[model samples]
Structures are given as C-alpha cells and as structure tokens.
Target: MRNGGCCPKLDPLPGEEESAVRTSHWRKELERRRDSVERETDGSNMKTATRKKDGEKEVRAMAPLAPQLCSRLAQKAMMRSSVTKSMASRDRVRFNVGGQLFETTSTTLANAGRDSMLGALLDDSWNPGQPEYFLDRNPACFSVLLDLLRTGALHIPANVPQKLLYREALYYGLLDHVRNAKWGPFDGNRLRLADSVPGRAPGDGTAIRAAPDGGCCVAHGSVVHVYNWMLEERRPISLDYQQVNDVGYIDADSIVITARERLGRAEGGMAVFSAATGELQHRFRVEHGQQPKSFTAGALSLAGPDDNRIFSSCKGRLNEYGIGMWDLNTGQQGDFFYELPGCSLGDADILQWLPSKNCLMVATLFPRTDNCFIGLLDFRAKTIPWSWSDAGIVVTLEDKRVLHAIAMEDGHSICVINQYEDLGFIDLRAGTGTNSAGTGVRWSSRSKLMNRKVPFEESCYPKLATHNGQLFSCMNDSISVFSGSEHVLTSTLSRSYGGSICDFSIGGDRLFALHNEDNVFDVWETSPSPII
Candidate 1:
C-alpha cells in the first residue's frame, strides 16, 4: 500500500461495498425492464401492420362487386318503368260528349295529338282518378272524329252537314286531319270533278288562286269571292271599284291583293286582307325619290312559303317603273329594282321567283308588249344573268309568239306556250354570255303531234304550270298533261259544262279551274293511292 510513498490506498468499508452491489443490481434491472418495453412496442407495431394489410386486401377484393350491384339495380328500375308505361298506355278512357257515352283506349286519344282537346284527357294531372270525362260538344261530330282516330279514315253521314262537321273539327283541333281525309293529294292524272261553284258576279274571273288550305279565291273585276274547303262562301273582299290586277294568298288566313291605282290618289293600291273577315290588314306603299308615290302593282310573285318577300311589277307616272320588293309581314318597301335599258320590268305580265337559283323571272309577253322579253334577274348582283327576247329574231309562220312562260321544276329551262298551242323551251344553260338573243328556242310539236283541233270560239291564251314533275297546259276547254323527260303527252282533263278555262291553279291537293263562259269554276280532287 505504501510502495510509492506519495499517498496511501485504503480498503473500502463493508457497508459501502454492500450498497454499491445493490445499486449495480438495480441498474441492471432497470435496463432489463427498458428492453422488455421496447420488445412489447415492436410486437404491437407488427400486429397493427398486419391488420392494415388485411383491410387493404379486403377493400381491393370488394371493389369489383359495387359496379355489378349498381348495374343490377338500374336494370330493375328500367324494367319497372317500362312495365308502368305499357300499362298506362293500355289504360281505358271514357268520354260523355253531349250526353252520348263513348269509350276508347289512352293510345287512341294520344293519336289526336297533345295540342288537341281530346289529347288533354290523357294527362295524369287532368282530373285524376275520374271515371269519365264530360265534354259539352256535338255528339254527332264526336262520333265521326272518334271513328277517324280509331280507324284512320273519315266517313261523314249524309245527315251531318259539312260545315257543321268542319266547325266541330276546328273545336277539337282536328281540322288538318279532316282536310287530309277530304282531299288526299294532288294528281293531275287521277283527278275527278268534285264540285262546280257558280260565280257571284256577271264578269269572268280575272284570277283564281288556290289557298294553302284546300280553298280558293276567285277575283272578278273589283270583288274577290272566297270559298272554304267545304265550298261554303265566306266574306267577299271588295276593292272599292278598283280593278284587281293580281291576287295571291299570303297564308291560309290572309291574302294579298294588287289593284290599279286610284284616279286622284298618290299611293293606295296594294293591300292585304283577312281571308275570313275581309278586313284590310295592311297597305303596301312604293317610294320614289325618297317619297311615297302612287304606283300600280301588277303580276305578284311570292318567294316560296318560307320566304317573307313579296315582289310585284310597279308602274308610276314618274320614273318609278321596275320590280318593287316589300316585307310581307311589315308591309313596308324593302328594295326597288330600276328598269334596265331594254328590259321593261314594270309592264311584265309574269313575275316568278325561282328559289333554287335565287333569281326572279320577268316576262313581258306579246300582249303586254309588242315583243316578248324573258329575263332571269339576280337581285344580289343587281344584274340580269340570263335573258331572251324576240326583238331581233325572225318569226316564221310555224313559230308562234310566246304568251305565257313558266320555269321548269328542274330549274334548267323555261316552258312557254302561245295562242296557237305550241310548247317551246328556252335553255337556261345554253350560252356563256348573259344575252340570249341569237340563241334560238327549242320548239316542241307535242301539241301538234297529238293532232288536236282548235275550237271555233276565241282561242284562250294557253297557260303553263308544272307540279310534281308533270307539266300542265290549258287550251280551249281541256288541260293537257305532259310527263317524263321528253315531256310526252300523258292525258287531257276536260268537262262538258265549263267552257274554256280562263285561269287554273293547283294547291293543297286540289285543282281549281275558272270557266270564262258563265263565270263558273270546277273543283277537281284526287283519291288517295292505296298504301302498301
């Protein structure tokens, strides 16, 4: 212990040695407890990780089943809806019209159309849970309408008046159906004379225009007599003793009339009138030098049903002589085409608008002018794209002067007829230049080939019309029908009583021919072709 002699080393006390041993043992026990706690935590973390992995696997396995379940649910719902609709459509309905009981299916009433009165009964909110509907309407007409809805055919008993039937149809909103059933479709070959209406005035009708709805208006002097589809005379339009130059239907309810200018008036001629009430709705005015001036409108030409433009040849005391355009709805002037150098548009006897080419055909024929002038006017370019005239052409004895001209349906040529019953064709695509002077017309001897003799009476100026690929021409008392590409003579329509048709119009599945002898008019209708 005292080897170095610097300091002496002493042995530890007994109690201190024992306390150090106990402290060492307690330190080892605390380290052991800390190791045990770490092990337990690691075990708990492993369990949590395994549980999370199991949950992820379960979710991935169940994902495909969801869409299948939704698809099954949707299919069930659609099947249920379809079954319900089928049941509802087959539901029975009862109607008591004017104390007469009638029964039908919901499907039949649905055919009456939703806008019709009968169709209103099919609505679920309309008197729900009601056993029967009571309508305060005529039972006889109801029976006819019901049969029409069920069988798709209309048959009127002799006891029921036609006007009464039509009035009832209007109430039920079935007038269109009735009109279709009455007159099927227009066929010149299958036409049959349905009726002959006597004229109201003493003079021959100047014009006969067919209405959109199977009706017509006959213009005689200053009076225009309108007749409905039932051949019932409606209110006649009076022009205050002014001569009617041209008349046309603006719609089923309104008509545009062009009359000669008054003696002292400056601007009051063209007017629109209510077809039903004969009330004047509008008066068209012509302007020259930025001022409204008096002018006489002649030869009205309406641009198709969808177009809103009304074109007429206007003539005035001043230099306002040309084709005037007006708004059909507003009755205001839209544009004025001044007369060209050699073209007299103001005195054109025929003005026809060609929708396909966006041009208007102006024809100043033989009677209107010494020489016949036919021109195709392009409004957008303000130029005559194609024109033809007999001014310089030599006329032989066989060649007749063109009296009336109508553009063909194909829009490639124009068909013209003369007093001598000759049909001539003018090619629209013949020359590269606008002037068609030296280009001769292709004349057809179809009328002469048929060997038809002219009547002894004053030969009426033959009129030309084309409908549904068929060409129609009237000579004396007969209308010759031409068909096919070559326009071969197909048939002729004539009747004994009506002598020499003055004017004829075709529209709404009907043809109206006005006779010049007794101011009588004939109504021709075609039977509906059997549906295969």
Candidate 2:
C-alpha cells in the first residue's frame, strides 16, 4: 500500500528472515528490563553489572531518579507487596514451632476453633502477625498435634507414650481429638483391677467385713465364710436362720451375727459363732420378755473390744421399736437399751461404733414421711446428744437425700451419702440437743455428683467406708478416696473386675469389695511408691 511510503516505507523481510531479527531485538530488551527489576527488588546494596556482546563485563550504575517519581514508584511497590501478603494470609499459615518451620492452610486450623491454642495463635482479630506464628513446644509432639488438626485424627508414633501424647493433646485442647479416636472409658490406664475372688454363695454378695485378725467375713444366705489373708477358707459358720442381716468378728475366732427365724420356727436373734471350732457359742433372743422382735431388717455394731456387748436395731410392736443391747457372756437382751427420747423412731439401725468417744452412730427414718435422721448416742449420757434430720441438711435437698453415713476419724463429724450419689459431711459438735426445726447440726457438701458415669437409680446405693484416716466411698464399680482433713477427693479407683459392687469394706490394710455376682469379691491394696 502507498500508505507505507508516506510513513517512510518500512518493509517486512521474507518469512523467517524478518522474524529472526525482531525476536533477537525484543529478547535483549526484555532481558535488560528483567535485570533492572531484579536489582531493585533483590534487597542488596552492591551495584549490578551486565555483559556486552564482546563478552566483557560492563558496570551499570543505577541512576538516581527525581524525588517525586521515586516516591510514586515506592508507593506502587508497597501496594503490590501488601496485596501479595493478603493473598498468602488467606491461603495458608506459617509457624515457627520450637525452631522447626511448618505451614498449613487456614481452614485446617479453623476447624478446631479459636478456643484451642493453635486457633488462638492463628486468630486474625487479636493477632496481627498472621504470616508467622511461633510456639515454644516440643516439635515432635507439635507435629502430632498439627497432623490431628489437619486430618481430624491423631496419629501418634509408636515411640511416643500415650500418656505423653495425652498431655500434649490436653495442652492444645485436643483432648476431644484423642477421645474421638478412642471409645468407652478414658481411665483404663489410671486404675487397674488387682485381684478378684468368686463369691461363696448364690444370691449377690451382701456384706464384706474385715476382721481385726487379718481375716475377711463374707455373708450370704444364712452362712458367713471367713477367709484368712491368703484367701484360705477358715471355718464357715452356718446360722440356723433364713436371713442373716450382718456379721462381724468379736475376737480372732469368735464372731457375732444378727438374723431372723426361718418361717417363724425359732426366735430371730443375735448369735455368736466360733470360727476355730464351728460351734454355736450362744444366741440371745431379739425380744422384750416374750415379745417376739425382728433384728433381720437392721444392722449390728460392736460396743467395745473388751466390753463384751453388741448393739442391734430391733423391730417389734410399734411400742417396742428401739435399739437393743446384747451381753456376749450373759446372753441377755436390753429392750430399751437406748430409745429415741420423746417419740418412737420409725426405724433405727446402728451404723458404726466410736469406741474412742464411747458413742454409737445411728440412722433412723421418721414414720409416714420421707424424712430421715442421723443420731449420735452418747453412751455415758444414755441419750442422743446431737442429731441431724433431712430437713436440717438443706430445705431444698429434702428428698430422702441421706441414705447412709459413717463416722469420720474425728468422731465429731459424720460422712454421709445421698440418694443422688453426692457425699457430704455433717458436723455433730455444733448442734443443740433438741434441734426442733432441724438446725441442730450443720452439713457441708463435698464431692457432689460422684459416680457420674452411673446414675443412682441404675446402680446399688453407694456405700461409705473409712480407713487409716482416709475416707473411701464405694460408688458404682469404683472407690473414691477423700482426705479426712480437708474432705477433698485425692484419688479414684474406677476399675471393677466385672460386676456392680453391692458392698465394700476397708480394713486389715486391704480393700474388700462385694459385687452383685454371687460370691464374687475383690481385694485391693495400694502399691508402694516413693513418697516424693
């Protein structure tokens, strides 16, 4: 076209000949610009150089620019840098973990939420340093935690102990991670079932009594089996009765028992047995001058080691309901050994004996009401010096709360268990004798909602037992130990061999557990460890 002549007649070379020159010239220009940009952005102060076509090095001085032009260029460069940083923050996060570098996507960590340590560190609202996070933790353990965050699963190495891994997971609030990894109880490693012994009878284990002579007495049906420390069968005493309420050792070989008549053939009474000879030493009728009484529904507790007297709760005509006494040698029963002062206690039972204080701790249920009472018998005064009723515990806690109680080592305080599986202490030393409005004694709650894994209605009544100044509570299949001084829970033994516990006792430096399985019992002792 003639237009090219007017513009000075530039002509295209034929085919590849023209393309070759154009490509070579443009490649040189691109290389020059690239080298200049690299020099500006490389963050180095040294002057750069270029090579000429003759292969000789040519020094290039970066020319100083006008102040306004340089300022505009700097602003554009800063905007680009900020945009790059924003994109990186949205896509991923970087961490300097214990000097070890790590990176992951933002969404991966957000799944655990900001409450977790990792999420808190990555939170943009509070943390302006989004590109890099630093954590002072074991890199090896941190790697495991990060993997859990990314994959929603914890894959711990074989060399890492689970306990150590658990500790790290807890620190990161990743306990739920491990919990989701495992099912059932999380305390399998904390407690162990040491030993279990089969029950000696058919109907669930009723009671386990540890004798003073290192022997254990297990009661079922009408017989009590005594076992030496080695689980060897000592003489088994078979009582001539239908039901045996309770049994305890009066001496190394002699034991006392409370029972009822089988079909009303014989008088239901308290009897003594000789473990060494399997002989019926004596039997005292649980009656008041020919008025047949029943002790089968009640409990028994020894008066004193040498007093040769035992206390029992006897049921008879409404007028004869009271606590009875038995003289081991005289074979005599006291009708009104100690009755409720003004009114007849609906139902009373001796729960424990405080030899040091010469007092008997008793539990009574008020008639026609859900109210219950815990009384302390001052043997010297022959009356109840202090008593606590359900109304007195807590007005809001008036729903048959207390089921059983045990005198603490102090003798002035009693540890009680409620129907709700809660443990509390009642101070008997502060109460006035009358306590008309249920304000005589004071109750302080401790270890509430224990046995949370098993509800009270689904399990047997939790039992309380104390030994060596330590308060032990048999809740469900486990035993909770509390410091007698502060009433704070110190330890929990939740391992049950196989069945639900019906009763338990602590004595003879051993813990005896009676499960619902017929004739099944377990023994536990603290394994020695360094005091420090």
| Cα lDDT, model 1, residue 87 | 71
Which TM-score value belongs to model 2? Answer: 0.56
- Please, what are the lDDT tens digits per residue for candidate 1 over residues 201-259? 98778999999888999999999999987788999999888999999998889999998
Q: List the residue pairs that clash in candidate 2.
A: 198-519, 199-519, 199-520, 200-519, 431-440
Best by lDDT: 1
For candidate 1, the TM-score is 0.78
- Alpha carbon deviation, residue 427, candidate 2 (Å): 1.5
- The candidate that wins on TM-score is 1
lDDT tens per residue, model 2, 405-461? 788877777777765567766666665443562643344444343324335345667
| Backbone clash total, candidate 1 | 1
